[model samples]
Target: MNLLSLLRGEAFKRGIHPPQNKLTAERSIRRLPFASRLVVPLSQHIGKPARAVVRVGQEVVRGELIAEADGWLSVPHHAPATGFVEAIELRPSAKGPWEQSIVIKVQPGSTQEVQVAHPRDMGVLNPQEIIAAVQQTGMVGLGGAAFPSHAKMSVPKDAKVHTLVVNGCECEPYLTCDHRVMVEHADDLIEGIRHAMRATGAVRTVIGIEDNKMSAVEAIQAALMARHIPADQIAVQAVPTKYPQGAEKMLIMALFGVEVPSGGLPLAYGMVVLNVGTLAALGCLLPRGEGLVERVVTVTGPAVQRPGDYRVPIGTPMKFLLDYAGAPAESYQVILGGPMMGQAAASLDVPVTKGMSGLLVMRGADFCDRDDQKIYPCIKCGECVAACPMGLNPSLLGMLAAMRDYEPMGSQYHLGDCFECGSCSFVCPSSIPLVQQFRVAKQVLRERAVA
Candidate 1:
């Protein structure tokens, strides 16, 4: 980065600052007890579903590969516990659909330790080898997108990556898993950054943390000092605390003062951004030669009794997690992530996937009186326009969405640029579900294209 970039503070325009209800920010991550039956979804990521390799009734050890990647776009699945495969059939997903899943009944004395036969020397692995190792780990973006990590590292042959932008900005309200990872797993995170740098062939890395996480910044700085890496190679920079500041484009702009071209990727501009949690986990897992079978999830919200960060094994049922967290049996809505951009869970039967960062449970009364409950007509207010970080007219897009003019929303209005961060909906005085409309419109457009 140039002197001008350094002088330009990490500030992005037009983002709403909702209450930072980060209940577990100070809480250390504790491991949850294994649920009786774990439901491993084959399609836990954004790509093709994994092909199951284990038969029903087969015994599997923890971290053992249970499924193989179906194609280049897919990721494999690992057993989250030492258990017997109970069944392989359709199971309820948080998205309101039944998906092919492997049901594992936990063994009587299943241990938390993974069965690793050998540890690999990461120092000897080349870039391609590192990427292949990432694929073997079945790693994905733990930042909730769940895009395969290996795929991100597999930059195009023509692209030349200069910097590996590390996203430590846990800007979403009530989600502190990434924050805790940065603070508690600093060594692993630095190691992960090194792996990412090697994989992406980037000479330097910049960790853009939100100002709210000063402790995380300090922790990363200490780690870097202990590692003896030059500041030019990797440095931690604090960005302003703002909603949607954690978005890739927003963080990129905040750090480098460069806006990714509309409908283009950061890779196009010689950068590869990876989430702190994803890299930390990769750093820890790659050496062990283990697959991603567990992750740290923030179980918090107004409705949770034992609110804190919990190291949860993947495929643990929502009901089991909630029960462990002392959630009420009465009617309460569960959002699988933060309140801003997270979606409401369709059912409690959904098993925790690689994408889940936090489980936010709230009673209906929590939002009963909020303006969002009752939809109102757009008042032609420019609140959304001012709040949108992408500089798109959300009011116009919302109007277009209501009219089902989806094509123009993309073609003329640049709907594809909107990352759906929910700032527009938060600031809309009329309580219009502008973000929800955009989501539906985008989904409809995808379906239309397929048709």
Candidate 2:
């Protein structure tokens, strides 16, 4: 059966088919020049913030560790470019909070070559050593999760991981960085998979690419053959293209036909999933003994003039990027990631982080005026129900949210299951902002639980 033929039948039910808007899918990745100054947020990852090791006025080279991992949950931060530390103070973060960050003033005429702290041969390292080495590279999910890669690869001693699922499904619209990585970095991807297999003890690896990217599938297959890797040990499988198909649970279902138990993880099903970009970077960095200071980001959307994928340094500010990408001088909305799940930029001062995959700039004229439209009552239309990929009742959840009945929204309605994909909000005829309501409800519930 062809992967394209299985699009509707095999895909998870109730995902919206939004316009792909992949304008720069074919654009090759280009390097973005260093910003005058960069801000390295200590709290970019999900866990404890890294502790700054460099003092103000200290000169640092690219890839040199500026901060140390505070704990096992945290990952160290590396200098994105050769510069002198101007300050280590509070800086604007994408999440609308002031976080402790190391500000570096780039030295003019610096080549910005990465200074490898130490090089290691992966051939002699044991599984534990590989897991330890993953932390040294400062790797994270790269798919917007920002979860530490080392923590994810380290399974409990008693548990057995059967498969390492590689996510090549760049499901989010306007984000082609991952797609470009799959096409151009196939060799690194294969090498990364080998290390991941050894680390997690997965007998085989299955890379799930959306059918829309058949070229990626072919590229990966060719790389596997060129490296003389067997098909059974590593395979590229194209699942149907759908929104949120890049999500771990949905991708697992599309590949193995099994659902991860609710409130549990893919690990519960004896599987571990990693993003292709994350693994590809790991493949290139681990052998060179370098830290992650740069990533491929898709700079695109209507407001962008030179829309393409750029190899962006970790701490490059949004304003610098927008200027380089040739955005209009007029008003526009700049989003840090894709429209579906990305957040509106709080400020252009916020620098790009490890998890940021794309920068989407939308002209004001591109979207409908939300404030101008009146929010009508839901007529109990089943559109939201039909569009929700998680199979939750957005109508009921919205009602509960309006009534301030937050407890039932979670205990009874399973509001915790919502991943905020905005599918329900997109299809709502009443324009009630169902996803926003769910986010507020979840936050309230969490606060109450903490109280």
* Top-lDDT candidate index: 1
lDDT of 2 by residue, 378-399 (tens): 9998999998878899999999
User: Compared with the true structure, what per-residue lDDT tens digits does model 1 show for residues 134-191?
Assistant: 9999999999999999999998898989889899998999999999999999999999
Task: Supply the global lDDT for candidate 1.
Answer: 0.90
Clashes of each: 0, 0
**How well does each candidate superpose onto the true structure, as a TM-score?**
0.97, 0.96
Native-to-model Cα distance after best TM-score fit, residue 99 in candidate 2, in Å? 0.7
Misplaced by over 4 Å in model 1 are: 1-8, 368-372
Q: Per the 3 Å backbone cut-off, how many clashing residue pairs does candidate 1 have?
A: 0
Pairs with steric clashes in candidate 1? none
Q: Model 2: runs farther than 4 Å from truth?
A: 1-9, 369-372
RMSD for all candidates, in order, please: 1.6, 2.7
